[model samples]
Target: MDWTRQTRFSDPGRHHERLAALRGDVAAIGGVVRNLTVHYRASGIDFPPSRLAEIDTRWVSRMLDLDHERFGGAPLDTPRPIEQRLVGCCRDAALLTVAALRAHGVPARSRVGFAGYLVPNFHVDHVIAEYHDGSRWIGVDPGVDLSDVPLTPAGLHTAAQTWRAMRRGEIDPSTYGVGPDHEIGGPWLILDYLTRELAHRMGDELLLWDLFGEGIPYSRMEWSELPTELPDDLTHLDEIADLLIAADAGDDAAEQKLGARYAEDSRLHPGATVFCASPRGARYAVELASVNQEAD
Candidate 1:
């Protein structure tokens, strides 16, 4: 299927009837605004932790189907526009944007990467939705709009782009990562996002905290020593990086090849468990097999 087409996650289906209901004027929305009331907050800006805890509903359909009461907000019977919604996370915003675009027959897909502009000397882990506008794929950050920063086709640095840039010494590896208290973004983080983004392009868009590879933990800081226990064949990353770039450029053949390669790569394949972080910063793992069975 084409990247623009909706999957189980992106498809709003009967939950939200029209794309008009989801559209928001980007000019009016600023970058720093966040939904303080919701349990899940996905920004550098902080918010009070929610009193109640629950598993994150990562799917766009599930997000649309959710009631305001679910997040301790006011009740709403139908889907609301972006301005009225309490979701400010990049993943949520990107998914909604993709759903809206796909509803209007636009080819769009969500991308996971790092944004350097968000923090000085740091590349924060971020996700954005990109839509093909006949000529090319343009990145759009639905979560925040830094009006001061000029927009361009390559404004957002994708994982693949970052990896290549880092390899060429164009950007410092120490500058790419998440969290303010510690160093998280580096070669490891870039590689992780690169793998995840590759999986995302192939329609296996796993949750933010989903673990891949044998030794890589969900949290980069958790590693006692950086770059420990990594795969012996790290050279494959260069090929994966090239494949991802090709896939992003709308090369269907490259995407299919990537899907096959990704599946065969034990380091990139979906693991038996997924690490989930709670509102209170508690981390736990869900058995992927059991979760799939329950979904089935």
Candidate 2:
């Protein structure tokens, strides 16, 4: 896939001008994009219920709209207090970073997975932007202060990597999830994110909470809708995880095979609408659209 091309989710639209000012600085851009859960706890800031819903703003243009509306066309370097920033999740940070990088003619895309840096022994589901630096893809965590630094294991632990590890019994799937306290991690979650990693790799870069696969047994509308038991396809998911891992390891043949598999399988790519189980609140179906035309 062309990582440089803007997906509908990453296209800056009318706010295209704003991205130019950021100069493709992922770390600085991440600052202006407030993570909903992180900033709230750090600042102890109470917010309107509607404000929380901003997590569902999937389009980069819409996010920029909110940013401009709040800050009045300020440059991304200009620090906005936590309260004034657009409330979102790690996915927002990654999407905006990818958008900014793509704006400056850099090839970038978001990667979805679990992170071990958040909680000790727990891999929190996370997203980060990856830019193709001529020869290879580099991961950058805009949501953190790791500026211009290469992502190590302490940072983003890809779901594909973790999935393979779980399969080998090298790590427990239960330790990888939403948070330490939240009841959201398990092998099922890992199974879910494996599809997410594939989708991101395919350039869809959908939200982390968006489900995949066919029907209730293999997929659900949201985390709340998940079945108590694991999907009856651990063996199937393991095969997918193996392909994804091999591709990431720079196997040219594996990349070719994985790309073909993803294209042939509808489950690896989201359709016209994503069933959003917004962490902020509420569950709804989101119609997918790319920026074929500039916004109003």
Candidate 3:
């Protein structure tokens, strides 16, 4: 099976039965994550802090199952559709959005990167779902609805675009990172996004905490340690950036080469069981070690 092709992870066949069970507002779907941040303030409801702490659910089926379990039998959950439940982060939202789009015959995929406009002075870690309309791939933030906000490079840029901008000194690499307290930015963050985005483009969209190959743990390391930890040979990354751009534009050869290159690099594993940190700082094992093997 080609990693570029959709698999059970993106296929929505099993969700057909529940499609009619409840209706969702595409516009408001992206606001689900925002509402969680506000504690459903727009809805005038106060949820427990724990409601927004879990981040384990990675599959669409599990996410929908959890949604149904929380709202399926209750009329209270129906009145406010935007604030249904909060069980995931940006990656979960992107994956579910991709599944929803694919169910409707749209070519969609989840993207792992950073959003420069979401937070002040930081290129925050983020994920989004992109859909192709027979010509171009449009970025869609599954976690935040940008219907009101104008779409701009600052608001939402793919990992490739962000990398290019960083390479050309268009954007300050020091300003691109997770947050103020965790100033994890610069070349290391770009490299992390490159690997994650490359995996996502290849159809293996992993959870935020999931580790890939010999990728450095910049999230946990001190800023000074990043340079020494990163691979010595990084010239291939520029080639990857170009290949990603071509692949996005529907170049089959570029996609094939990208997949082949990724496969040959032992440092870029598609599967590996590593400890993943939750939003609450709790650590647990995420089993993605057999994902690529199973796909084959």
Q: Which candidate tops lDDT?
A: 2
Q: Model 3, stretches more than 4 Å misplaced?
A: 1-8, 11-14, 20-53, 73-84, 147-152, 215-230, 289-296
Pairing residues by index, what is the TM-score of model 3? 0.75
For 1-296, candidate 1 gives per-residue lDDT tens digits of 58667875677666445443433333322221223113144423343343223225556655544533454433232434433345435666677677767776778777888876666656678877777777876677756653222222235678888887777778877767775555555777788888888867766666665556655555434544654544566678888888888776768898888888877877776666656643345566656544222111
- TM-score computed on alpha carbons, candidate 2: 0.86
- For lDDT, candidate 1 versus 2, the one ahead is 2
* Model 3 alpha-carbon miss at residue 269, Å: 3.3
Winner by TM-score: 2
Put down candidate 2 lDDT per residue, 1-296, tens digits, no spaces: 67778887888898777777664555555564543223433346677777766767777888878777777877766777777677777788888888888888888888878876777877788888888778878787777755443343567777888888877888877778888788778877887788888887777777676665555354444456767877566675677788877777788788788788887877577777667765665666666764322111
Worst 10-residue lDDT window, candidate 1: 28-37
lDDT for each residue of candidate 3 in 100-125, tens digit (9 for 90 to 100): 55555567777766786778767777
lDDT of every model, 2 decimals: 0.60, 0.72, 0.60
Model 3 residue 205 lDDT?
A: 70
lDDT of 3: 0.60
**Per-residue error (Å), model 2, residue 204:** 1.2
**Residue 156's C-alpha lDDT in candidate 1?**
60
